[model samples]
Target: MNNWELLEIRESLLRDLAEFIEDNYYGTPAPHEYRRHELDVRLGKKLKFSSSYPQMTIRQRRASDLLLQVGLCGATEYALGTIEDEDQLKHGRERLVKMKGDLADLMRDYDNCLSEEERKLLLRQAKNNSNREESLKDSERDSLLKLVIGMAVGAYCYNPAALKNDAVSDITKDLEELGISISDDTVRKYLIQAAAKFPQARKA
Candidate 1:
């Protein structure tokens, strides 16, 4: 009914959506459709809960329930393994490169439009925003590359004694082509970590 109550419910819904995405996407094995069915059932239970947030009006309840349903579908599609993981990696890498180029152009345009004093202030703000963007992009890039490394390591771990050395070259070359600054040694380290993690999962 009140703004705070609405805001609180929205935040809770967002956290729930994110949890559904992460748990279903990475934690569950295929076929993901089964996990999606389970998610819908769990979401139904959550919606029935009468929390401290003032009782939602009929319109508000309908909107919130619809949002949950739509969010689940969108998350499922985003995390869907319809394509090979390698293909998804290439797509994500390309998107980041395009985003960087777009940001560069935007900064240039913004700089051209400002007065000298305003430019200085805006530049400071831009730099701060840029740092935040870089941090987030770095994190996302690391996650995607880890998946790449996992694929290679999974193959090697399939039969460790017969492991081929070219896995490093494979991942390193792809990363370099995508403008990732990591070294071959770093890639090797990531592969080693993946190897360790995969076996532990298998044992469990």
Candidate 2:
């Protein structure tokens, strides 16, 4: 059959499957015996059916789960001419390929559907949002740096050996206690910056 004919058939099958799930699972209750028999006939299996509500729900959910895979395989087969790939066709790789192709098609359609002015407006809004977020991050980083420098200066005033290894270890622990974790190396760097900023504090 032609690809168009195959797609049409698959669409009809999906519609019928959806209707079956809705009616039997979501519609008014049917006789358990009848439902069980119907399921057996449709599935071509002679398995037992449980009368409990939970068991019925499980079966219905299983039926619904098949809908997506069936649709994916149908679309993949139609687009790729066949669903038979030796290396890339097993274990849902084919579905992933189909999903990526569908996403590309959707993006293309979205671009085609929007006007040039609308696209430009969206781009401007995205850029503005990104810049605002970057500005906020810079402000936060500056505040944190100032706080660290002040702490480093205070430690230097309290102890003349503030930039030494033991002093840096103590500063690192203090920063951790204040919920600001800094490595010993970073603490030493901040201490050096603080000493440069406050030469009098280092001399005193």
Q: Which candidate is the best by TM-score?
A: 1
Clashing pairs in 1: none
Global lDDT scores for all candidate models:
0.46, 0.44
TM-score, prediction 2:
0.24
Clashing residue pairs in candidate 2, if any?
A: none
Q: Give the range where candidate 2 is weakest over 10 consecutive residues by summed lDDT.
A: 44-53
Across 25-66, the per-residue lDDT of candidate 1 in tens digits comes to: 423222233344345435634654647335554434443454
| Model 2 lDDT, residue 48, Cα | 19
The superposed Cα distance between candidate 1 and the true structure at residue 75, in angstroms, equals: 5.9
Candidate 1 matches the true fold with a TM-score of 0.25
What TM-score fits each model? 0.25, 0.24
